[model samples]
Target: MPSMKQVTFRDLWQRFAELVHENKSVLNDLDAAIGDADHGSNMDRGLEKAVEALNASPEGSLRADAKLIGMTLMSTVGGASGALWGSGMLKFAAALPDAPEVTWADFVNALGAFVEALSKRGQAVAGDKTMMDVFLPAMVEIQAQLSDEESLPASMVRLADQAKAWSDGTRDLVAKRGRAAYLGERSAGHIDPGSLSSAFWFEALAGAVGQQ
Candidate 1:
């Protein structure tokens, strides 16, 4: 069995905050290419509230903390991405409540749940060049890999790679949803800002797991 260590909600939130802060400029640059250029600011606000919620966790378990994070982001982020991302967090919070450690399978399921929630809420599909461009392939790869074997770190690394691929590949796809969708063919050749930001976020999560 692979060794595992528990991560506190507060610690995880701080790590996420650090990840966003470190990549905020990059996210902004990516957004400038194909979006309104506010993803970084929006995400930063949401994560700051998430950190606060983590700090205030005095009752309930990890699940509740996750739900709180979801709710905070939903309330603060205030965009199509925020609503979908927040829904994903809320769904996952319910899925893994009270677990001492997260397994590879659990993590994969959570990713699927996040994507599913987004799909339901946003009603988008593959090649939409939204964040779905990053998550859909990454989740599919994760589902395929984890079905054969179970290695948390390995799954995380693979997912991160898939995310990177999707991010890069989005440059070849035309935007078909959200604000970028308005740009039509012009959206092609420019990476979807949402996709790029999501790639960074997954990479950060992989880093967090690697640290453990």
Candidate 2:
């Protein structure tokens, strides 16, 4: 029932949760280097609960779905990732139309709100070796591609690659936020687990959009 022009909120989150599950070990390994080795486990647990909540909920409004995801992540996920994703998703839910589906423009606008919330809450920027490294650049690319009138599915493919590249770029940055920051220069050689998971988030979007 999905179209190329629009994506259902349910499909999006489900795909994201799937991607995280598939890459759980990789994420945990990445986190092991610079922080506590629980990023993968925590996110996987949280997203699984979020998906279960989505499946159980009767209402299908976009805002409701997003808010449910936010609250579920907040309650289930632990540490900074939980707080950032949970609170940011609340902002995302608030920015959305209370409908079953939304146009690509609406999705992008809501995503911008989510990114802004993350930026404000995490206080991390492009060079901080955090999730923002991927998110900030992805936002710029998404907006630019939107303005160019590119199809969502195609643009999402490119965005997924760009997200991974941005996440890769974090390897050399000294961590300025989160538990990794405690390691100082030692964090420089490792990728941020949050950024890797963020890449999976974009990859999931690409998969959902492509399937549509």
Candidate 3:
């Protein structure tokens, strides 16, 4: 069994930057089908700024780094995505401990806080064809697996897999929130860009943690 790795906030941000940059076009394509086609570029730019913010004022604790990322995204990213994502990041930051390395419970609690923040910000629930569709269920699975005493990488991989399934499930859901709701039944076939991007975030984290 692989030993648990200590994941720093810097590691999380760097991995997010790389993954979002690499998959920007794919996210844009998904968005183009259902909503504004700028999700990819906007997220990429925001994450890039987040990386810069972290580098400029290196924080010894994960909480500080997460706050910097949240603020940077809120100020730099465009569209509603910026507000929602930034709010979620801020909530995650608030939930984290002052320590540099995060334990499994700390990570799970942070994610739970993020989900709650996002749900409140977007006023979205499950099957809303929103990122919460992916987030809510993924968090459940992550919480469940927390009892297994598995290595962090293994647990993250499972969560990423669950997130992917939930993201894909968004394809069949009619939009109940956001601009996509304007299309009503017409939105059923297209994948939700937000949910997909959220999945990418988890996948990137899993990949980053696995490498360690």
Please give the CA lDDT of all the candidate structures.
Answer: 0.75, 0.89, 0.84
User: Candidate 1 has what TM-score?
Assistant: 0.87
Rank the candidate models, highest TM-score first.
2, 3, 1
What is the lDDT for 96 in model 3?
86
Regions of candidate 1 where Cα sits further than 4 Å from its true position? 1-12, 147-151
Please give the ranking of all candidate structures by lDDT, highest first, separated by commas.
2, 3, 1
lDDT of candidate model 3 versus the reference: 0.84
For model 1, how does the per-residue alpha-carbon lDDT over 1-212 read when each residue is reduced to its tens digit? Answer: 33223463345467767777777877777777778888888888888888887777775565677788899999998888689879988987777737656665665566677788888988778899888888887777766765433466667777887788888898989888888888889889987777877887677666766666
Off by over 4 Å in 2: 1-7, 147-150
Give the better candidate number (1 or 3) by lDDT.
3
Q: Which has the better TM-score: candidate 1, or candidate 2?
A: 2
What candidate 3 gets wrong by more than 4 Å, as runs, is 1-7, 147-150
Best by TM-score: 2
